[model samples]
Structures are given as structure tokens and as C-alpha cells.
Target: MTLDGLPERGSWKGLRAENGKCQFLSWKNDFKPDGRFTITFFRDAQQTQPIQTEHGTWSAANGKNELRTDGVRMPDVYTYKLTDVDTVRYVSLASDPSGDCQEDYDFIERRIRG
Candidate 1:
């Protein structure tokens, strides 16, 4: 989709997978002047905390205007886009060596409290 078709930062709540995994994505400092601001999610419900990686952080250099989680990379990096201010999408760059362990994710942000 075009850049305008992406989601805005903070508009997203989190990412929930079909396996009952919930990931939290947040950004602060307007994409700069922040420390380890990450957009992370869980691999499954078993995870007590959000996942972390090198690419996942709160920075303007990551995505459009919103923060995205990785989608197709080895460790994956999430970034943001502004397809629509109200709608945010999470793109994951998950990867596997043998291609058999493939575990990737892509989702949109949904507001929980309007």
C-alpha cells in the first residue's frame, strides 16, 4: 500500500495472533529522543513479556509515521506506516533457517478504548 495507507504511531494498541498471543506496540518521544522504544508482541500466551530484537525500537527511521514490528527478517523488525491515521498495521519480518520453522506475523492496530 501507499505511504498514506499506513497507520500512525500510538494509534495502535497491540498485536494478537490466532494462537492467543498478544503483543504490545508503543512509541514515545515523537519517534526520537527515546530509549529502546519498541513495538513488540508475543510468540504465544506462554510469553510473560513482549519479545525484543535489535530492529524493534521507537525511532522515526523505522517506518512511515507509525512504529512497525519486524515481519520478514531473520530476527524481524517492526515499523510503522500512515496508510490511515486511524488504522495501524504491524509488519513482521520473521524468518527460519530451514524454512520449516517459519514464524512470521502481520497485523493491524485496533483501538481498545475508542
Candidate 2:
């Protein structure tokens, strides 16, 4: 990862689905200054409406991108690494002994001016 890895402002998208289910998951992430960040989840590619939204803050933690979401349900900490200028690998720090939420997901981000 380089200084140009996580741009000051941009968007990232990724998809998640289980067991060939019709209901899939899409993540749309927006980055901004002042430690503000927003992650929106859409059920489909059209992205017409968001099924859930998480408001959070992002910053560097131990050379990794750390995100702390606000709310009781959301994970308190998430760690990410920018594999390159256009891709990001994200994983939640919270443990899932059942192997449900422990998988890593890579998001392909689109650079945007903000």
C-alpha cells in the first residue's frame, strides 16, 4: 500500500452472497476527511435502495486501515489493507467462532473527487 492507496475521497464496491441465494449483498463505501465514513449495503447491483447503512470513522491503525462503526450491532473494529491502488482487502476484527463473519472480502474502489 502507498500514499495513493486509499484516496482522500472515493468509493468502493463489493458483493457478498451465500449458498446461491437470491438475496445478495453489495457494499458501497465512501471516504472523506475529518475521519468520516459511510458504508451502505445494497441487495442488488442496481443499487436503487440501501438495505442497511453503517456510519463510522476511519483512520490508520498499526499500518492498516481501521474502521470503528457507531452502533450496538456493528463491529467495533475492522482492519483493512489496500493491496493496490484499486483494490482493498477488509476483515472484521471481531471473532466468529462459527466461521460465519470471519471471511475476507476485497472491494474494487472507484476514485471520485470530493
The whole-model lDDT of each prediction reads 0.41, 0.61
Q: Write the per-residue lDDT of candidate 1 for residues 1-114, one digit (tens) a residue.
A: 133343223323544555534333332112223323344344444444545532334333446333333353344345555455455566655433532224456666654334
> Can you give the TM-score per candidate against the true fold?
0.38, 0.63
Give the lowest summed-lDDT range of ten residues in model 1.
Answer: 26-35
Candidate 1 TM-score versus the reference: 0.38
Candidate 1, superposed: residue stretches over 4 Å from native: 1-11, 19-57, 62-76, 94-102, 111-114
RMSD of 2: 4.5
Best-matching candidate per lDDT: 2
User: Residue 12 in model 2: shift from native, Å?
Assistant: 1.4
* Model 2, runs deviating above 4 Å: 1-5, 17-23, 73-79, 95-114
